[model samples]
Target: MENHDAAALLEQAAQLDAGDPLARYRGLFIGTDTALSYLDGNSLGRPLKRTQRDISTFIGEGWGGWLIRGWDEEWLDLPQTIGDQLGRAVLGAAPGQTVIADSTTVVLYKLIRAALATVSDPARTEIVLDTDNFPTDRYLVEGIAREEGLTLRWIEADPASGVTVEQVRHATGPATAVVLLSHVAYRSGFLADLPGITEVAHSAGALVVWDLCHSAGSVELDLDGANVDFAAGCTYKYLNGGPGSPAFAYVNRRHLSGLKQPIWGWMGRKDAFEMAAGYEPAPGIRSFLSGTPAIFGMLAMRGTLDLIEEAGMAAIREKSLKLTAFAVQLFEAWLEPAGVELASPRDPELRGSHITLDHPAFRNVTAALWEQDVIPDFRAPHGIRVGLSPLSTSFAELFRGMAAIRDQLRR
Candidate 1:
């Protein structure tokens, strides 16, 4: 499987696919046409076959048949119910700590604001983050800092390597109130040391918030074990929840009582159905919710979650490492000779499910590849992301995509 020759690598890919334990699960998802190579799963995943059937069933039976009765029977707690299922299968969190609602931006804002509200020290005036974080994350933190009159401690992460634990330690201190960062860098595909950074931020008396938009279902997460104070992520990418799927928010059970999310609505109030005047926050994770759940959008994710739970994250991670490793092997043999450089971390353990390669012509190369039915997304400053979704992608498919990149570079 580690052959340095392209023809040999293609042979190895087929051999690897023959024995792949997760190979059976690929049929569960849609978009299996051999004419294309989908290397953008980190941006948007393919919908599950079951998702279409489930959506039809929901509309016909759950919504159409039950009418308003659906709320009392199942819709009222869809957020928390699905959150628990996601927590158990992907997030490594216990029940009652995660809830699905809002977009990634809204959920991130709520969690960041909730953490900021808990800061009691006047000296804690800094919000630490990296320059390479996702655009929405940076915007939300900048907006919050400007509105709250706080300082932003920017961590200048290497665009290729991402924010490291030492960078976090140096950036956070007594002056830092909240440290926000991506669990995986969106552009470079660098996976951060979640537990180590959380511990460092805690020692500095700052709460940590993670944006899991890139890493959520692609990598194994232990929010509880890492002692992550707050987290927000989207279900559209790795979770395969469809476009415009509801995002999730996680608050450590210990912080539930004290955390005050900025947006308070009737849904977050205790006895919400009673229509009380004063807003008494609902106990536990429900208080983090600000509005009615997106029940329709969440339906597709359930089928994908079922597949994830059945495959197990450990198995998925194992397959991910292999696929990415094979990709790297191909790059060393073919793409590297064409002056294409690896922008993502070379160490497999330091990388996420995706890999980024840099070529001066990548912008145009991406455009050309799209015309030829090989898809990889172009990032700014000459980078192309090769995102591998373990359940839907095969080693042979990965080879085809990498070979296309190599052929285009030769042209």
Candidate 2:
């Protein structure tokens, strides 16, 4: 595709976007006065109008009126409430299995340690995780291994292709205590075969903990159907929870009864307010809680989850594939010939809601795009990530951003 030809195709994409069913959702976000073409929704989604209002109400009514009594009003139950909504809406898990608290890193640490403790055999002293898993996940796992004197088996995955079920099978053995992986590759946006990988880990007598930061709100997950052991994710991405919103963790119903959290804080005690003489874990997933909940962050997540439930995960995923396909098509036509390579998968089914492109000048190009109010993120070793949230991103915005990149490259 020549530069001129690519420009023409982008123009055509704009025309097609006008009739898209999800087009109107673009208006629901808080747009900037500048020409900000935000393609980084995978990192941090644009705040919804409803979220702003909810935050106001929370501060004014929930905190001011209820005061410390807010605990009795509904603050304590918000975690489970939002968790149930996230489960029914996206996680595909039963109630009492999901709770919203802490960040993704904290949740990962808690779950990984708990999982490792469960497999207490001396031979099971190894943790299996992909090299391509998010940096935070890898770091957390490494820290756990160091603390527990366990071996870290890093599965070196193809940077662009992501981790596979075959690779996971090869890496897992009798010594594998826990298998940690991300549902979607953060750099390549490749969606892992969750069910297949989970089956492989279980076959090796190991538990699996999935980082759903990229997949929770953007993809349709059947954690219950898949019999996944544990999971964690953030609300700030496609979930449209505000930045720094609370994260969620999930333990399978069957595992919830037996699993013991390593961080046994007061909240996880059977009678939290009893100020008990000894620690007695509460029944089910509540045992995972460590400290006081972030009420404001939880409220923000509640507002976002409400929107997700209303829209439905199936619907969100359907439009997500379409949006990513549209961006991939645009990239193939426009950037391929300009020394830009598609870093993400070409197959729609294997990809997530983002399309990544690789170029030698990606760092500079990304900085230039930001100056022009086109917001796409730069990953390490020359990769530019364009994250399109299906609920909020429009075809026009995608085309505009890609066109800007093309224009900048030509100069």
Candidate 3:
């Protein structure tokens, strides 16, 4: 942890990279350059090299050739197909409980509305949310609360440590209808106790909805094992899905029977071609779908999910812990003395794949780093998010990125 030892950080990084089992996986991405250090994979993951072939094939063979017929044979089933793959490979969920469609905001809106319907009690009209949740999530919850006349119970969590199980327990009560929280804090990379928090919400007769935007592919999630009621996440991050790719939603089988999503479209109707006048919801998870699947948006995810299936989430998670921990160690040694503060949890068990460092000069530093092609996102109030994707990021890349930050600060 000493600066003298830290001076050899680059050499240490090379040694770590040489032994990393997942090291070769980094070459599979589109960008494996030695000069460019992409530190924002938690925000947007690098595309898989296989994705280029997949997209080309889709354009020529899948879309160009099949056209309308593709709808029935393949395109129509993409939502459920990819959803099942994601559920099995990454979510630890069984089939029929997950589906991919719409953006994260839309999916979250539908799931939240569906969850609200399940709670028939007029008195249970409060929605509990953390203050530091993603802006879109907070906005969606705020809009829903205003329209439904529900109260918002805000849990003010530390930006560094995030919302703890104890904080969640204190936030929910008899009046709590639903608790919306992010599995990993977006700004600080704080990993919440999913199973523990879910139990506490259920104990108070409230259903919990998790936003897996930051945790989906980065963390090892067991939705079924955790007995999570509902969840939504974007595929563009750790899943390596392309920008603006459609998000996924999961509903428990128990809730699927009676869950009534607000959006009632032809896709969710039992029979679409029949053109029935009356509205009848489709059976099971299909009801969660209200529009045509984002076939093009989902194309890249197929390749990424294939890689995830090959590597296994257990191994991916193991690497994520080491990568982030190494970043912390490097931060403590190099950046800490350069007036950089560790904004993320020190304990790797309590954190996600990324680490945050805070300094007053980071606003301009991040801008300058971007020009130098060392990309790490800057959050307000001086936090720089160092997003490390396990499959795509290497220790040498992490060291170079951190060293660049250190060098920039000294100037």
Which regions of candidate 3 deviate over 4 angstroms? 1-7
Candidate 1: where are CA atoms >4 Å away? 1-4
* Residue clash pairs of candidate 1: none
Q: Which ten residues in a row have the lowest lDDT in candidate 3?
A: 1-10
| Pairs clashing within candidate 2 | none
Q: What TM-score would every model get versus the actual structure? A: 0.97, 0.96, 0.98
Model 1 over residues 1-411: C-alpha lDDT tens digits? 334466788889999999899999887778775668999999999888899899999999999999999999999999999999999999999999999999999999999999999999999999999998999999999999999999999999888889988999999888999999999999888999999999999999999999998888889999999999999999999899999999999999999989799999888989899998889999999999888888998998898899889999998999988988998998998888788999998999998999999989999999999999899889988999999999999888899999999888888
Q: Each prediction's Cα lDDT score?
A: 0.92, 0.86, 0.92
Q: Looking at candidate 2, what is the lDDT of residue 169?
A: 93
lDDT of 2 at 410: 81
**Model 1 alpha-carbon miss at residue 259, Å:** 1.8
Return the candidate ranking by TM-score, descending: 3, 1, 2
Q: Is candidate 2 or candidate 3 better by TM-score?
A: 3
User: Model 3, residue 14: what's the lDDT?
Assistant: 87
lDDT for position 38 in model 2: 90
Provide the global lDDT of candidate 3 against the true structure.
0.92
Residues 1-411, candidate 3: write the lDDT tens digits.
556686677788988899898887888898796589999999898988899988899899988989889998888778888999999999999999999989999999999999999998889999999989999999999999999888999999888879988988999999999999999999999999999999999999999999999999989999999999999999999998889999999998889999899999988888877889988998889888888888989999988888889998899999999999899988888888777899899899999999999999999999999999899999998999999999999998898898889888878
